[model samples]
Target chain A: MAESRHLGDIILKIDHISLSFGGIKALVDISFQVRRGEFLAIIGPNGAGKSSMLNVINGVYHPQTGTVTYKGETRHHMPPHRAAELGIGRTFQNIALFKGMTVLDNIKTGRSLKIKPNFLMNAIWFGPARREELEHRRKVEEIIDFLRLEDIRRTPVGMLPYGLQKRVELGRALAAEPDLLLLDEPMAGMNIEEKQAMCRFALDVNDEFGTTVVLIEHDMGVVMDISDRVVVLDYGRKIADGTPDEVRQNPEVIKAYLGVGH
Target chain B: MIYRETGQYKSNYGADEQIFPIRQDRIGVMIILALAYLVVPFIGNDYWFSAILIPFLVLSLAAIGLNLLTGYAGQLSLGSAGFMAVGAFAAYNFMLRIEGMPFLLGFILAGLSAAAVGIVFGLPSLRVKGFYLAAATLASQFFIEWVLTKFPWFTNYSASGVITAQKMVLFGYAFDTPVSRYVLTLVIVTLLALVAKNLVRTRTGRDWMAIRDMDVAAEVIGIPMLKTKLLAFAISSFYLGVAGALWAYCYLGTVEPQAFELTRSFQLLFIIIIGGMGTIVGAFFGAAFIVFFPIFLNLFTSTVFAGQLDPGMLSHLEQFVFGSLIIFFLIVEPLGLARLWQLGKQKLRLWPFPH
Candidate 1:
């Protein structure tokens, strides 16, 4: 499953990315590469532009200066849906499960980019639409099985505890069957046990689906444990990028981030 | 014991995704259908059909349409009755101007015309949200009524501004009697409601609910908000439009712009709020509550007062009671009567084992 070794080409490359809001810069000359089939963690203090970087990668924000190259091809002004259809899936910094929907329905919506059910067929729900629905439902159910969400498949996500809500958000991202999964603060606000579960699932997703994961997290335990490499951000600039041990020992990183025990 | 489905299990996704997944629910629906189709036409009196059942069925359909947009999609729409007016007039115009145009085609075309108008009004939703979108839709309600009234040709220039719908013929049979009209209304509502039920459980329905929950997240996840929101508006309007046509042609047998006034719009809004937002069955419960509450109040006040109280005072009392009840339901069970129905079903599922 390539768990021990990340021996693949660079899959996503961001070059000289610079973004500013009015007079303030959110990201300045932040450059990094995400290797194929690897877990990459971005860690920083508050206002570190970690989320903004992920947003840029997903086409939610167009950086003032940058070229996002994926799979050796430079990106264009593709809409978010087109980017999602191109196999880029992400969960929100805060849990974004549809409040009124059941866990199963929320995950099924993750398959929206891939489904081909036309308006009329969806309205009637017979023949091809039914077949497509079953096919997608089967996929979603398998994800439900994978994430251990079988018990609460029919429960509205808003009613669930915070930990379960984050799990459902992860399940939705996984439902897209994406090549690159971006998780923003997936383990935030979770207890140790829930944090452990989320890390295990993140690793399992990389191992089983061979999905390359890029995550923004404040939990150094998780970032250092599962991440193959770490990128540290402070004040919209990348201070250090290396293996966890290397970044942990770097003098500048220690002074800037680890000095405050972040 | 009849409520239980302990031994039976769904074998596949298709079977599992069945609208009434529980075997007991399937049977319950069948029993209700059997009663509606066979019993009502024969046993129900004319007063029951004309005064109670026809309006109930039509308004229920209208409620479902509004629920689709407002409840399921989280798009506030106050122009539902206006869309209904569009449908009624569109059908009337189609019937009047065309030679030998079938009533069925007229109905479909009317719904389509409403859908068109609905999309036009829904365009503002791309730029606005929440209460602003609602205000835009509210404008449609007044705008449509104004156009229908000012242009007397919509009513065929009748002095009284009423255009009586000719015999509602289906397969050459005239649906003129109260019983026949009730049957037609019932059949149409049932079929549309069934289609809506099927819709909400599927991908398209999920998209609408997705936008309703969080539009930004929905867009980031690849749901095209513009497409989804407008489609919600279009489909919701189509349902309301069809209901409007039924109200005029089947219930009133006439087209009058006043029939679908702004008050009618508010009535539809109240239907979804009290019925349970985002539920197909909630539409019926809400409509029933809205339609029957006034009648119940009138009867109760009349019997209690025994004609001693002034009718105006009694009417005011009825309004106060109705307003208070709406507030009570909203505060207590904000999900509405549909939520209550669900709770009842859940309780029934575990009956004989109290805990």
Candidate 2:
């Protein structure tokens, strides 16, 4: 717990990253450093490669150029599972949840790396397997309570409302206890109240769990309020990167958000 | 009224996490066990054992195997009979070649051999899925049957290509009697079904389901796609293999490669689809339905028609009725009999009040 509170070192560094799909470039020369416990927001117009950037960070997309450094280990390309193993967790822009699974089971899957898998032990439900399952069940229960998903704990995720599904996805990501949590449009399509709730959860996760956050959001007000720093992207290029106040005052950020003068 | 769980408060996680958490369910399972172990052996004649119970039990085990891959892992397989054949022939070979090899040990070895073949065939699942994967797995069915039929060595130089299974003996006690063999099958099936139940509630089961539901999210969440898929195949194949061995030694009393044809694989697929995919109990439900429905049709026709129809026409009628019923069940209740059972339990919980 103490280890999570004291945060200073750069946990994730996306240095000079350039990703392209054939003729089109999704991201060009995108460089940023995320410190531990920082709430960083990436805000941009539609088609600004916001999701593609998150995909890059979580190793879903291997950029054609530049290296990703995490916990001092640098790599040109990493698989998504490898990123997950290195304490990086992400939710999809389109809400990628296990639709068939119950809320508890979905969250329990987040604790996959915590326990060693043994076929025989699991088959008998004895010794370490049983104990570890109970132990993680307790942990997952705590997450369910934290997310206020107690009533629908046994409900299949596909049956839940979109907002609740988003919360459950957050719970699933939090269950991993990742050092870096990437949330893509967590508050998208939600009402004002649901957006407020999501914002509170995001801030609480940043403050309480000391989890470094890289959020891709379009809500300028929400992004400006909760984020410690904002990185603005336009047409796959980083326009401005600084604190909200500094970036808001910057002429280029304004032109990007508004439009270029005739 | 008796199916409720009003006062069953679980003080511990262990208690809450049981396979059958409800007291009524636990008692129901106990009763079923009692009937299967104590009552059935005495009451069931040879016809019942031969025509219904043994085949049901064996197919149920195979259904569980298919469920693990298709139901849980989202990998469509069409080679269950091939795996079963591998087990039957492998068990035969083990007992034949190794001096003084116990039949039970040979069954285990047969399962392991099938698991190995399962992994080899399962390699394509990583790159392909759904119908494509099903087509890929079909190779195992044809390849295994060909190997068994073409090679004389598998049958130990038998000209007929159908080998008589070795006698079942444990500690010099011959399981020659129908009741004894039924008991053995029941014990093995029960233990294995429980193991399957336990497995589905744990880490391995979760991983398979995760892959099934969403591979991308599963990968992002650190569930390795290759390892989980292959493990599902291996375990599922292992179960099918044992079921095959049981089919040969206990049910059929003869091993023939042709016995595990492509149609048998489809039969196993139907069992899971109609039983309820992704459930251990659904396998039993499906197997029971498959084994009993045809008999029920025949009985109904005989009683209603009263010898008016010819035997050939009656047989065709039975097939037609069976096919229609399967289609009806699929359209009416796609989740299978297990979901229907769950709905019934839900209704029972709200009974007396009409809620």
**TM-score of each prediction:** 0.97, 0.98
The DockQ score of candidate 1 comes to: 0.79
Best by DockQ: 2
lDDT of 2 by residue, B141-172 (tens): 99999999999999998989998889989998
For every candidate, how close is chain A to the native chain A in TM-score? 0.95, 0.96
Candidate 2: regions farther than 4 A off: A1-7
lDDT of model 1 at position A227: 90
In the range B1-355, model 1's lDDT, one tens digit per residue, is: 4687788887888778898888889988999999999998999999989999999999999999999999999999889989999999999899889988999889999999999999999999999899998999999999999998898988889998888886678688988899999998898999999899988988889999999998877987899988998999999999998998999888988768888988999999999999999999999999999989889888899899967888889888889999999999899899899999999888887897977
The CAPRI classification for model 2 reads as: high
What's the CA RMSD for each of the models? 1.9, 1.8
TM-score of chain A of 1: 0.95
